[model samples]
Target: MNDDRRVYGTDRGEDPRPQPGRVYAELVGGPLDGQLLDVTGWTPDAILDGAALITEAGAYGPGGRALYDPFPGDPSRWSWSGDTP
Candidate 1:
């Protein structure tokens, strides 16, 4: 098992306990070298007693673009919100 764990937000804030809604997802294959690849995005339900799409299927980032702009590894590379990349 790759044992990959990824989450955009934490349960303490994003998802409160007691599970207020029902979630859904569609799983794609994994990455090479035994890496676990999973993409997730949620949609809120608008109606009464109706919940949002907790997880949308195929909502992952586009692949093959080689977009790897990550958080600045060096403090010098980092910039404030007011600054441009």
Candidate 2:
């Protein structure tokens, strides 16, 4: 929801660098299985600046789903493949 831009080189001729972003969430309820959370925001060039998103030992929500709502991602915004979601 915010835009932050940074320059790479000392001179203005150099290209601009983009400040990274992250989405956090808190799972209300679900299951605790061997799942790999494919965080969709990051791309090839999107460097993982500080932490690793996915982990083996994950925390839980009210029922069981991983409490990932740190960045407040809206689950309704999630889409799927095949035709479309």
TM-score of each candidate structure, all chains considered together: 0.16, 0.17
What local lDDT score does residue 56 receive in model 2, on the 0 to 100 scale?
29
In the range 1-85, model 1's lDDT, one tens digit per residue, is 2223333223454532122233322122322111111212422222111211122222333321111111234211111111111
lDDT of each: 0.23, 0.28
lDDT of candidate 2 over 1-85, digit per residue (tens): 3423332112476433332353322222223222223334754333222122232233432322222222224441221111100
Q: How much is 52 displaced in model 1, in angstroms? A: 20
Candidate 2 runs further than 4 Å off? 1-20, 31-73, 76-85
Each prediction's RMSD to truth: 16.6, 14.7
